[model samples]
Target: MSSGLIDTKPLAGIALASAGYACFSMQDALVKWMIATYEVPQILFMRSLVIVVISGVLMRVRHHPSILKSPYRGTVVLRAALMLIAWLLYYNAARSLGLAELTTLYFSAPIITVFLSILVLKEAVGAGRWIACIGGFAGVVIAANPSHSPHLIPAAMCLVAGFCWAWSTILIRLVSRSESTLTQMFATSLLFGLACAVSFPWIWRTPDAEGWMLMIGLGLIATLGQFLLYEGFRYAPASALAPVEYTGLIWAFAYGYAIWAEIPAWNVFLGALLIVASSMVLVLWERRSEISARNRAAA
Candidate 1:
């Protein structure tokens, strides 16, 4: 029940963040598989159903009825809608894109988060953070290599998805000030599930046994990943946890290779290196800034 900004457990946050990204990587892989045969809305509806059930159970187990209530209901609904849009775009892109490539593009979220924080939260970002953000996007451009006409649509989708996700992250941080993590998760699940369900009449299709299992796995993994991510933010500053998300590149590459025999081009590796390094610089800078502020207060 610690608020996202007030908690100061960086190590635990990093660990949770890393684990959450790993789960997300896996979920993306499954979604990639499922989307080949199923509609995006269908996949979303089923996966969100699983999330609602699991998150509801967790809320009940925690015996926190407040987890079902939120003072910021409007923001919660907006965040959930943004998440749903982001997922739809990402998954649609995933259906055609290499996992690593898609992930590299989506990794733009952290950078976008920085700028959004500046604009929305009025968080004063230093020159170093700005440089890091520029460098990170430069890396994304290099990795994306959008010159290839065929990749343009999917790449653009990923970029927009990253933007939406960044906004969702900001909202989560804002709402976490007064909302329980469970409330955040539950509301997001319920809202997104309902949204997707509204499309079920047009998108619904019978799934084979294999499809059923994969869809269920997708739900479970995504729910857990999102929960862990929310918890990670609760334990540490988002900047400190940003770099840990780069670990998903490794998972994406591994899953891409193992599942689809897909290997990223050399530019992807290079771009990933730049992006990860830049993001880490921002994280380190933020950590130092936090330390300096604490010391100044103590003095």
Candidate 2:
């Protein structure tokens, strides 16, 4: 009974992580579907509004109203503003690039997160992980190939999105030290929604029936995706969740081909796989080292 219970924990974590990635993949597909018909600001506003409403209700019910309170109000506001920029840049990248390319570039988040944690959060990162980060970025270069004439705009947009995301990740880590993830998340949604709402007047056009459905789908899936991601983190260590996140690539490939008829090239796939594999190994290494250190201290 004890052995079975122990084995079950990791399995459950794996399932939760995979489910989270699936939800996120669906959200990306819905966003891509709407990009053709909806203005970026309109889509951002509606989707963020939906998330704020839903997450607010959840927080109220969970007796986690403190999630709305933050010790670092100014930092939280700046973080939310950065998130707004990140989302806008990311939406533009998705609009201009193929789904596969956008998704692949987004995976660079974990790598960026590590570097930011080391520099800003003062985490002790070793030399090996730094080498892995370098390799991961090299893979991004191979995948993006910005020097190529045709891929220039999308490539540049992806880089901007990545940089913005790196900043947001650093801000989130800082906020998480003093505030709940729920607080940070809800604040971000509220701020982003407001930004979107303000921009809507300038860019608003009435969405068609198809557009409405797509936007609704985008909001719903994104909300669910974020919920699952938070839940998975609650249940599992980050190392356990990292591998499952790669499943997003499979979903990206399927959705891109089925919906937009956009197929990734050989080099893109190779580079994406290299980055994912390296990141996963780095995560496993970190987790094992942590576990060993804990055991030694206990001993």
TM-score against truth, every candidate:
0.85, 0.77
TM for candidate 2 is 0.77
Residue range 5-81, candidate 2, lDDT tens digits? 12113345546656767887777777666777777889888888778888777667765645435567778778778
Structure candidate 1, residue pairs in collision:
none
Residue 5 error for model 1, in Å? 4.3
Task: Return the top candidate by lDDT.
Answer: 1
Q: Candidate 2, which ten residues in sequence have the lowest lDDT sum?
A: 1-10
Q: How accurate is candidate 1 locally (lDDT)?
A: 0.77
Query: Which residue runs of candidate 2 sit more than 4 Å off their true CA positions?
Result: 1-22, 66-68, 93-111, 141-147, 150-157, 228-250, 261-263
- Weakest lDDT window of 10 consecutive positions for candidate 1: 1-10
Task: In angstroms, give how far residue 48 of model 1 lies from its true place.
Answer: 1.3
Instruction: Count the clashes in each prediction.
Output: 0, 0
CA displacement after TM-score superposition, residue 173 of candidate 1 (Å): 0.3
**Each model's lDDT:** 0.77, 0.65
lDDT of 1 by residue, 1-299 (tens): 54336555555666778789989988877876777689988888888889888878877887755643557788988999899989989888876786446756888887778778777866666766676667766776676576534488888998899999889887877787777777788878888888888887787899989988899989889888988988887766554454465667667767888998988899878877886787677667767876887899899
